[model samples]
Target: MNQLKKPVIVAFTIITCLFSFSSCKKDSNNNSVDTDDPASADPTLTLVWSDEFNGSTIDTTKWNFEVNGDGGGNGEAQYYTARSTNAAIKDGKLVITARKENYSGKSYTSARLTTQNKAAYTYGRVEARIQLPTGRGMWPAFWMLSAKTPLEWPHDGEIDIMEAVGYRPDTTFSNIHCTAVGYGDLLPVPDYGRTYHVYATDWTADSLKFYVDDRLIVSYANAHLADATAAYNQWPFNHNFFMILNVAVGGAWGGINGIDDTIFPQAMSVDWVRVYQRK
Candidate 1:
């Protein structure tokens, strides 16, 4: 009887020690959740495409320069050029500079880069980390347009993930343009123009959600635009769309106040552009 009792006691002690160790490890792991990285927190997102701008030169295969001084139909002051002076890559960043100079019948020069026919996506998450420029006339935008061959402005649809007028340094705009403009709430962040921020849009069949640093700032649901016919004019986002990045000087909205010559040579730098989809 004594031998049996000793063996039983030893087994019970070993089991207790194992349980305590496992519980402590579990508690420690639970308390150490990382919150700084958005990807780690979001388990469903899978990276589909990305341009880190890691090289010293822009990848021609991914982006094409829209070489024109058409003012982008906004009566903008800058002449969009394909020169490296207006757009260049350095230190893993794509810089779009708006310079004050006489060029091609325009008073200023800038660059407009697009992934129009080169690349397009139906729906997913698209985002960019950008540092904006400042001045009275500076207009920087990160947006998307429909890939329709015969594109009609404000009719095919436009998704503005981010837009900022130089005069308003602390405000950011996100909007959708179709038959009518559907604007999002103005986001006021501290030192917005001077600091880098992540602007993103999660697009799906039913809704489009805009985010800043993974925080949802605005959302537009198809239900709001739903009508009897469900025409393409109202819900044109169902088709594939491409991305565009540009810095316009003194446009219809950006130049509402006026152009500031002192802010010439202003630049908007993009750290990276990423696309993702649900796993």
Candidate 2:
């Protein structure tokens, strides 16, 4: 367990004078305030979850690269590749890219990475700092799924912590989905695309809170969702879950604007992902 703190947006997003990142600097939101860079940032909370990717290659001990399109929810269009275009680790960041080039019988390519077995958590605050891939027809997500499915999908439960489709530049979606038995909710955050932003989800025994910076966008009260048996009958966010990071192209949710050939090999760089729990 980690220390607990109040959920404040500015404090959670970027504490001034500590290591605040302005998207204009790197032209990509993938970099956080460099620890040794000396740029001052003032944040009250200490580091809990982070991937300062300081190595020459992916950290096999902390993450696993998902290398197949077959597991992409049945409608994902891109074949996952291990190449730099699809995914690569460089300059201390994990970059996930979506491409339109043909490869191995698929017209598009992308990367999906996860911390399925390395780490799993039941609650607290989970955050991922990210800069999105540009152009139309792209879908990127920072999400989680129950590692131990009390029942299969629609039953096991899913937490779409942060998800955005390129066509809607200003609309961000923070949602949850369950079996057809329930009409899950898709909470909206309208400013997710205009710039780099941190998407967060806070969970406790009775509810889940969606946030964009300091704003509490939506709250899912436990009494409103799923049943006790873990069926799609309710919101099932009570179990341990693993994380997933991916940029998908031309899939059912992504292909809306049509693929932009000129933006081939666009990337969604992640600054880091950190989790918290009640101490």
Q: For this target, which candidate reaches the highest lDDT against the unseen true structure?
A: 1
Per-model C-alpha lDDT, please? 0.76, 0.64
Candidate 1 Cα outliers beyond 4 Å, as residue runs: 1-37, 224-228
Candidate 2 residue-wise lDDT, 1-279, digit = tens: 000101112211343333354322221233345332121122423334556565577777778887876627546678887776677776767788787777777888888888887888888777776778767877788888888844377566677777777776566667665543322234444545444566777788788887765357667667744455544357667678888888877656666557777877788887657675555
Clashes of 1: 0
Best by TM-score: 1
Residues 186-238, candidate 1, lDDT per residue (tens digit)? 57755766767888999998888988877787887786444634556567788
Shift in Å, residue 107, candidate 1: 0.8
- Residue 265 lDDT in candidate 1: 93
Positional deviation of 173 in candidate 1, in angstroms? 0.2
